[model samples]
Structure formats: structure tokens, C-alpha cells
Target: MNSKKLLLYSSVFAIQGLSNAVIPILPELAGEGSTSPAVSSLLYSGYFIGALLTLLPFGILADRIGNLKVVSLGITLTLISGIFISISDNLWVLGISRFVEGLGCGAFFPAAYSMIADWKDSHQSLGEFNFLLNAGLAAGVFFSGMLAELEIKTAINIFTLLAFLSFIFLLRETRGQTPDNSGRKKDEYGTSKRVKPPGEPHENRTGFKPGMYLEKTRETFFENGFWKLWGISVVLYGATGVLNSNYADYSAGFLTKPELGFAISASYLAAMLSSLAAGKTKAKNKSIIRAGIVLAAAGILFSLKVPLLAFFLIGAGGGAAVLGLVAAVSRVSSSGIAMGLFNTGIYAGLGLIPVFGSLFIGPLGYESVFLGSGLVLLTTLFVKFE
Candidate 1:
């Protein structure tokens, strides 16, 4: 990987870390603002919405143009969102800004994934890309946790600055790599017609357009052997979100300190360290993904009572499972569009699980969150390797 790619990946990791660190602290923010839990969740929820809206379009734009340009725009927007959130006094302001930030974040992963895929055409190189991207994500999570321990305002300020600086570092390196505007012939798909770019001088230019859009949605639910993986992803994410949302409260109320940012941060650290081992097993795609789900479920179950080591297991399990799944999916898909579908599947889990988890919280309390996640993982046993 070149320095530019490295920096770009690093900026993404840091941004993800900074933004994600906000999850565990939502409750705290809620109390500070005297808002309800549901309302506070909106802050987190808004981010996902931003992701949902921006992810698809940004990805298509990246494919149409250049990934580096998309990334540059994303980083700038992210910095602005962070700063806006840092200075805002009202929850709505913060929420909207976070949503905007989420949009930026939405662009980050897809563009980054596309770049990595385009850059490295080999499996080994793909593993390296996953490792580096995950490393940046881990580092960001750790720093976010550490920073959140400070005054929320102060932490936001510093994080915003760090995000800006990181973007600058990345922007300098990712110079060329933009989309080709010149007229070029379309590439070969597995089927009859070649996939053409829009506005090309051709017959229909409408090959598999409907099918292309529906690929992820259809496969995720209706396709054979997809339910298991999809179910696991959905459940795992919901469980993670629920637990993450409430962890600070659990720690402040029952465990060692009022601040569990470090605990949360530890999960990212564990993930970072675990990737060192997980990356080695990328060649064994299916096995690694299943192992990740199992580990994550087990970790969540264990952490229900054991506060001291909760994050360690959580980090190890979640990090390994997600990275494994990503590696597996990247290999399965030959084109960038398929990669977007993979991301959408994972983010769907990230997006939907918390909403479901929220419904169970009233009487169920925090432990149920883990149970829900575990149940979700049980489906992983059925996921097909293809």
C-alpha cells in the first residue's frame, strides 16, 4: 500500500472511532440533557440514517468518478459534522450534525473498500487491506473511548481537530485514482451483455439495472443459504448496539467507575490485536466467519456478569467475526457493486439491530440484550460458504 492509501485508511479508522465512541455514551448525554432514552438513541440512530441515505449514492458516485475524490469530500464533511456536534447546545443540532457525520462515514467504508479492491487484485493483498482498515478502526475506537472520558465537549473538540489533521494527511497522498470521464467500453460481466457506464452510446444501456439494485436485498432474505449469515449479522449488531448503549450505565451503576469509556475502548483494542491473528486465517473464509460469530456470542454471554473482562471478549469476538465476514464477502464478489451489497448487509445489521434491541429494554434490562445477540448468532451455523 502507498502512503496515500495508508493515510486515507487511517483517517477512515479515526473517524469511525471518533463517531462510534459516541454510542456507549448516549445514555450519559441523555441524562446530561435531561432527555429520554429513546430520544438520546436518536443521536445514534441519526448517524445510521445518514449512513443509509449516503452509502448507496456515494458508493455509486465513487464507482462513477474516483474513490480518492469521494474520500476527500467525505473527510471534509466528517470534520465539519464533528465540529458542529462539539459546539451544539441542543440535542437536535447535535443529532443532525451526527447524521451528517454519518453520511460522511457512510462514504468512508465503501470508497475505502472499493479502493482496496481495485488496488489489490490478489487474496493475500486483500487480507492486508482488511488488516490495515481494521487496524485504523481499532485505533479510532480506542482513542474515542479514551477521549470520551474527558468532558464530552472537550473530547469532541479534540476529536474534531484530530479528524481534520488526519484528513489532511490522507488528502496529500491520494492524488490520482479518480474515475475516467473519457468514453471507454464497458467491462465483461459473467453473463451475455457487458455492463456499460451510463450515457454510453449503446442500444439499451439498461442491462440488469433492476436486478443490480435488488441483488443485496433479494439475496439477504430470499436467496438460499443467506438467512443464517444475515440473521447472525442482524442479531450481533443489535446485541452490540444495545449492550454498547447501556454499558456506561452498567459500569457507573454496578462496576468499577462511572466512566467505562476505557472499557469500551478496550473492545476496540482487543479487536485490533485479534486482527493480527484473524488476518492470518482469511484464506479459510467460512470457518473464520463462523468462528467470529461464535466468539462474539460467547463473549457477549460471558460479559453479562463479568464486567472486568467484558470488553476484552467483546472486542475479540466482534472484531474477529466482522473482519472475517468482510474478507469472506470481498472474495465472493468480483465487482464493486457486489462489495457494496456486502457492506449493506453488514450495515443493515448495524442499522436495524439497535432499533429491535430498544424494544426489549423496558422490562428485560441489559442481560436480555446479550441473550438476543446470542440467539442471533445461533443462525450462523446455517450460513452457506458460497
Candidate 2:
């Protein structure tokens, strides 16, 4: 691969996996701050909230100003905020810093995904991206586990250093590189060779209108199969959130700091393999998606009896489902906008499910939260996407 793609992959691999690292170290963070695990989880929510707010806006910015700029800006933000995270003294500060990290991620992914769509077959390319994503998570988990053996602060500091290094590479790539405002590569003669993105008027190609973005998003919202597919995306990510936010607590006796980390990392490793396989499969999107939901539901249901097996089953199936959703969305709208909206659904589910599931923790017990996720995934069986 070229240097540009390499740098982008490195940045995404680190940024996406950063959350998994944090999950395993929650106890250390809580103890250091003298707070509860419940409070520490709000930090994840803070990141989700920032991602939820900025994805579409950043997508618009990428479409108008060029993806290279947006990604470079994102890398800068993540690098700076990640350093601040190492020094955060309280939940409030940590939340804010995580929020900034989320903003950077929100900006990076759609633009990066859009770029990948142009460089190669998006389906296969997306598979490679997922591999890096999960591989990075596994690496982060191992690193965090090691740091937990010493100090959580060291892990945070190392994480910041990695982000800084990624930023340097990304910055180098962006220099003297300029794509068109519409995010298309120029033809040899210096004119756009690709069609304009969704919702802009042909008469006035002058600049971005803030309102045009909203209109395109609204149009996609009402598209025939969009909401159905969007619902699946929501349920998928919600189930993931259910595990990430609750599994550490639930696995108290079954696993400890790095052990839970390793288990979750194994889950993502299975997902990475599954994603690569799915990309090569000719199966229909609905077929794979339904299979995935069913597989994950069964895993969650049997989790308490066999946690490791359950985690693997859930990750493997969920990987297929996630790729199916992204491929589905890409076909229906402007690539960047579609990806941005899709990400919004993902983080929305991530942010919302745990809040509602937390209620079940008091009455039905903590496992009930995962039970709710299983139920949510089960509901998709009766429905079809597109």
C-alpha cells in the first residue's frame, strides 16, 4: 500500500480500538479517581455523544472541503485531546476529553471510508478496514492489560503517543495534496471526473450551502429501504454497547482486568476473520444479516453458561451484519453522507441502549441488560431490510 493509505489505516486502527483499551482499564480509573464503575461508564457515553453530534456535519465538511483536510484536522484533534486524557483528574474532565476524541473519530471515519471507496472495491476494502479495526482492538486490549499490571496512566500516555505519531504521518500526507471540493479526484486536465455528491444544485457549483446537507440527509431518511436497514444498524451497535459497557462488571468472577480484555480482544479477532470471509461471500445482505442476528442472540442467551464461546459467536456474526449494513447504505446515497448517517445510527444505539438497559440492572440484575440486547436482536427476525 502507498504511504497515504498506510497512514490512514494506522490512524483508524488506533482511534477505533482506543475505546476497547479503556474498557479493560475502567476499574483502575475508577479506583484512582475514587469513583464508581457506573460513573466511569459515562465517559464512554460522552464519546458517543460527541460522535453522534458531529458525524453528519463532518461528512458535509468533507464533501465540501475535501477529505484530506477533514482527516488531517481529525488526526490533530485526536492527538491533542488524547494527551489531555492522560492528565484528567475527574469524571467531568475525562468526559470532555473523550468527547473531543469522539469528535475527531466522527470526522475521520466517513471521509476515510469515502476515500477507500474510491481507491478499490469498497466491500473488500471495508473488510480490510474491519481487520485493522479489530486487530487494533486486540493490540489495545493486550497493551491495556499490560499497563493495568503497572499503571493505567502509562497506558493512557502510550495511547496519546501513538495518536501523535499517526498525526505526524497524516500531516505529511496532506501537504501539497488537494482533491476537489466535491471530494472527487480531478481528471488529467484538472476537472472533476466523477459525478457531484447528492443534493447540490447543478446551476450553482460555487460552494457549500449548509441547508443542502440537511436536505440530502432528509431524502435519504425517507428512502424505501433506508430506515429498515438503519434499524438493523441501530440494533447491532446497541447489542455491542450492551456487552462493552456491562460485560466487565458481569465477568467479575469469571475474569479480571487483562483477562476480560483478552476475552474481548478474542471476540474482535473472531470478528476480523468473519468480516474477511463475509466480504468474499456472495450471499445476499439480508441472508447474512439475519444469520448474524440469530447467531448473536443465541450467544447472548447462553452467555452466562459459556462466556468465551458466546463472545466469539457474537463477534463473528456481528461482523457479517455490520459489513452488510455498510454495503447496503453505500448503494443508496452519496458515499460519505451515507456512511456518516450510518455512523450516527451506530453511536445513537451505543449511547441509548445502555441507559435503558441500566434500568434492568437494578431489578433483573446485570445479566438482564445483556438479555435485553438479545431480545432486541431477536426482534429483527420478523423484519426485513430492503
Candidate 3:
């Protein structure tokens, strides 16, 4: 990846880091924001739900116009939403602001992933993307925990400031151009090579028409193997959601918020290293994904026995499965819809699993939830990609 690609991926780092920055504070968000902890979690629910609802729509938009415009919009909304969240005393207003912030991030994701898919060694590039994302997530948890010790609002300031900075460069990068495809070169065998041309839109001679876009999107997402990949995505990512949504509450018995933040940071660091390691392997994507599932299951089961090292196993699996999923899904869908649907799989699991699983948490225990999620994931080990 070049400097431009690195910068582009940073936008996601900022968006995700900012969004997740609040997780460390979830246990106490109600007191700080003058609401209940359950309601405080609504802020997270709203964000992922917002991301879920818009994945297809914004994806369509990215496929039509381009990713840069969508990223610009996402960052801009994040900046504006931060302001509202900063001043608001009401939980309802805070939730609303978070929802809008989710919309902004939802906008950035598909376009951003789609952009990565267009880059050189896209598989490795996606790993690099995941690496950067984990780094950002780790930073967010650490800083947010630290900042919350002073004031809850201070934590929000960090990502918001980062968003404002990202938007500035995004505007500068996308100002007169879209992500450029004109600079690509062909090898001796006639394979096209990824090259930097800054950010400029790929020229679409077909031109976007309402009916045409609808037709293309339908054709792109509904083809054979699409739903299968989606199913796998939901299961894998939902497992992740189970881990994250319940993290703070689960850790409360064993660790402080800042200590938990350090643990979470360690988890992401594990994920970063996992992705980097996986990116170097020559194994089939299928094997990689299965290995990820096995690792995730082991990690979850281990957390039942030992919580301290659970982060490493689960985090490593998290990165591997996603890279495998992206590579796998792209094979099934030849058009622009692949990355968007992949993201939908992610946020859907993030949202849906926890919502349903929360019911079980109160009745059974965190162990049961982790056990159930892991067992469900292990069932997919036999699944084969076409």
C-alpha cells in the first residue's frame, strides 16, 4: 500500500476508533449522561443499527457515484454529530447523535472496503486494513478509558478531533476528483496493476441511471452463493458481537474499566498481529476461515476457564475470518456489491447477536452465551465455499 492508500484506511481507523471509544464507558455511561446503563448501551445499538440499515443504500450510492464522496459524507456527519453529542444532556439526544454518527460510518465502510479491493494485493491489503483498524480500536479503548477518568465528554473529543482532521484531508483528496482508476498499468501478461493516482473517481461510461443501478444491484447481490456467504458472515461476526457487547459487563467482576481497556487493547493488538501473520500465508482462504473459527471457539471456551488470555485467541480469529470472508465473498459477487454486503454481515452480527443474546445473558450467564456462540460457529466448519 502507498501513502494514499494508507491515508484512506486511516479514515476507517478514525471512524471505528471514534465509534468504539465509548465502549469502555458503557458500564457507567448512564450516570455520566444522566441515564441508565441499559439506555447508555442504546448509543452503541443505535450506531450499529444505523450502520446495518444504510449498508445497502450507501453501498448503492458508492457503486453509483464513488467511495470518496461517501467517505467525505460519513466523516462530515461524524464531525457534526460529535458537536451535538458534546452539548447534549439528554440520553435521547445522545442516542440520536450516535445514530447519525453511525450513518456517517456506514457510509464510509463499503466505499472504503471497495476501494481496498481495487488496490494491489487486495487480500493482503485487507489484512493491512484490519491491522490498522485494530490499532485504532486499541487506541480508542485506552484513551477513552483514560479520558473518561477526567470527563466522559473528553473521550468523545478525541475521535471527533480525528474525524475533523480526516474530513479535511478527505475533502482535499476528493475535492475535484474521485478515487482514480486511470493510473493503473498492465503487466506483460495483460494483468492490470494497482497504482496511485491520489483520489479520483473511476470513470463509468455506462453512466448511472436509476433503473440501471437497481438492476445492477439486484443482479450483483442475489446471485448464487451470495446468501451462503452472508450466512457465514452473520455467524462469524455475530460471535464477535457477542464478545464485544458483553465485554465490559463481563470484565467487571475481574477488572477495572481502565484495566479492561488495557485488556481490550491487548485483544486488538493480538488481532493486528494475527492479520499480519495470516496475510503472509499461502493457504486457501477456506482453510484460513476454518482455522479462525476453531481459534475463536477455543478462545471462547478458554475464557470460561481463563479470561486473561481469551483476548488473544478471539482477536486473532476475528481478523483471520474477516479477511477470508472478504476474499471469499468477492469471488461470488463480481460487481460492486460484495464489500457492502460483507459489511452488512459484520454489523448485522454485531447488532443482532447481542440483542438476542442479551436475553440469555440475564437468565443463564456469560459463560452460556460464549458457549452457545462458539458452538454455533463450530457448526459452520463443514461449510464449503463455491
Candidate 4:
């Protein structure tokens, strides 16, 4: 409810809203005479590709420079990319722009989560963040579908405008703020108190060594049951990624564009609600994760037959699972690096898993891909969180 949290949440909502605004209209964006399904897929996945490459580096940079600075830079990139997407009709151009836009997200998330990791009630804060994240996605899908009826590029233009506003607000809010270097500690009341700035001569300052980066990454990945958390992210996100990528086209056979958007939006809405619920719950993180896995698997298995219910289940499950995973990872040392690694797993799943599934769609069919993804989610039940 503080100004900082409000700014972070609002900025996330705008950027994420733009990210999925194009999904329902992927075919139109791909253009006529483009028979290749790959073009449409590229239009959708390019954002994730950009984010996948930059998340970790930005996390490291956030640790050095400042989180708010990276967040500001990310909003700037998103604004630029939104303009590019709005003006360009070329498929390749749009693809590249989407990639750049994703880079903006890659920059934002690790830094933002790093900031959140400094909070007193990180679990509840993360839940609230995730809730807004899903709300943005749902709004993007629903409004894009509604707006595209007026004009194909109308939704893109509108989201770009929102991004512009968010960027301006971010600049005003973060002006004159410097990076905190007290190493992620909080007072008894959960408010952060700054130590000597990073520029001060301190024994702990190693000045961005490559060996230290690798060492911290290795230690973070192996410690505190984080690998299990990372695996859960991969499976859960990968399953949803497969759904997000393929389900639109698959469902097109039965549903109209608006209806398709509604179905997808329903999933995100469910996620938003569930995330809010998860944050307030006292259940163990692992238990929540286990329940989430079951619900998601059920959703994926039934997606082909019951589109709305299936997606809703997936969203609900994903929301809870991610809240648990992120809350768990927030406990590790070097919050920036931990968040970087955690998000790297997310983008890897979102960007790469669908590409992996695409290979099987030709030989094994869409059903195989869905079933495989569902089974993959189920397999994670065996992963020990302790």
C-alpha cells in the first residue's frame, strides 16, 4: 500500500498487459499469405526469447547499480518497443520488437523481485505482485480481443500509451533514489534501513568479479532446496507456456476470437484470485505447490475438451505454485542473483518448452503435446522440496 509498492505494481501491470495483448491476434500480426505456423509462434515467443537472455545479467546489474534504476530502464525499453510494435507492419520487425519488449520485462522482474525480497512480509507482498501480474495479463487478453474488433492495431496502440504513462511515473517516483547496499536486511518493523552506499570502501565489495558471479550462482542454485524450487518453476511454467502458445490456434476451431480471449483471460483471472488466497494462507509452501501441481495437471489433461474450465484450473494452480516458489527463493542470499536464477528458469520454460513441444506436434499431434505437458507436471510431485 506504500507508494513504492504501488509504483512497482502499476508498472508491472502496464508492461505485462502489453506483453499478452497480441496473443489473440497473432494471425493478423503474422499477416496474410504467411502459411508458416512458425511465423505466428515467433511473434508470440520472441518476447520470452529477449527476456530469457537478459534476466540474469540484469539481476547482477541490479545488485551493483540499483534495482529502481534497472526498473526505470526496463520501462523505457518497453515504451520504445511498444511504439515500434504499433508502427511496424513487417513480421520480422514486430518479432524483433517483441523480443526487445521482453528484454524490458527481463530487466524489470529480477530487479523488482529483488526489491520485494527486502520487504518485511515477502510472502504476502509476492502474492499481491503475482495477483496484479495475472490481472494485467487477463486485462490485456480481454481488452485486446475487444479492441481488435475496432482495429487490429488498436489494442497495441492503447497498451503502448499505458506503457508511456507508466514510464513517466517511474521516472518521477525513482528520481534521486540510490541503490541500497545494506545487504537485504530489515528492522524489527520490516522497513529497510540503508547501510553505507556501494561506492564506499568496504571489505565485502569485490567489484563484480566473474568468479564471484559463478560462485554465487552455483551456491544459490544448490542451497536451501532451491533446485527443487527451480524445477517446479520449469515444469509449471512450461506447462502453461505450452497452453499459452498452442491453445489459441487449437481452440480456434471451435471458439471465436473474443471467446478465445475470454477463455485465456479466465485462466489469468483465476490465477489472480488464487494468488491472493495463497498469500493469505498459512499452509506449508510445499503443500501448496503439491496441490497446485495436481490442479494444473488436471487442467492440461482436460484442456482440449473443456477450454474454459481447463485454463481456469491451470491459472489457479500456476498462481499458487509461483507464489510459493518465489516466496521460498526470496529467502536465499543475494536476492538479485536468486531472483535472476529463478526467473531464468521461468523464461526457459516459457520460451523453450513450447519450441520443444512444437517438434512433436507434427509427428505425435497436439494431443501428445498436451498429454506430455500434463505428465511432466505430474512428474514434479516426486521432487523433494526439503
What are the Cα lDDT values of the candidates?
Answer: 0.63, 0.72, 0.72, 0.80
- Give per-residue CA lDDT, model 1, range 208-283, as digits (tens): 3546556655654444444445455666666666566556654556643223555666676777777778877535
Candidate 4 lDDT by residue in tens digits, 258-341: 887888899898887887788889998888888888988999988989988998999889888887887778765445678788
Tens digits of lDDT, candidate 2, 270-322: 78878878878999877888888887787787777777788788888888788
Model 1 steric clash pairs: 65-179, 66-179
lDDT of 1 at 172: 56
For candidate 4, the clash count comes to: 0
The model with the greater lDDT, 2 or 4, is 4
Off by over 4 Å in 3: 1-10, 31-41, 114-130, 171-224
Pairwise TM-score winner, candidates 1 and 2:
2
Which segments of candidate 2 are over 4 A away from where they belong?
31-37, 120-127, 175-205
Instruction: Give the per-residue Cα lDDT of candidate 4 at 43.
Output: 76
Prediction-by-prediction clash tally:
2, 0, 5, 0
Pairs that collide, model 2: none
Error of 1 at 359 (Å): 2.6
| Model 3 agreement with the true structure over 1-386: per-residue lDDT tens digits | 35446456767788778887877776665454223334544666778888888987887777556565676788888788877877776777878888898898788777777766676577777767766777788888878766777887676787788877777776656443432365422111111245533433454547666786667666766676677777887888787677666777777677776776776677787777777778788988888888888887788777766655786788888778777777777778755556666677788887677667766776677788888988998988978666
Per-prediction TM-score, please? 0.78, 0.87, 0.82, 0.87
Superposition TM-score, candidate 1 onto the true structure: 0.78
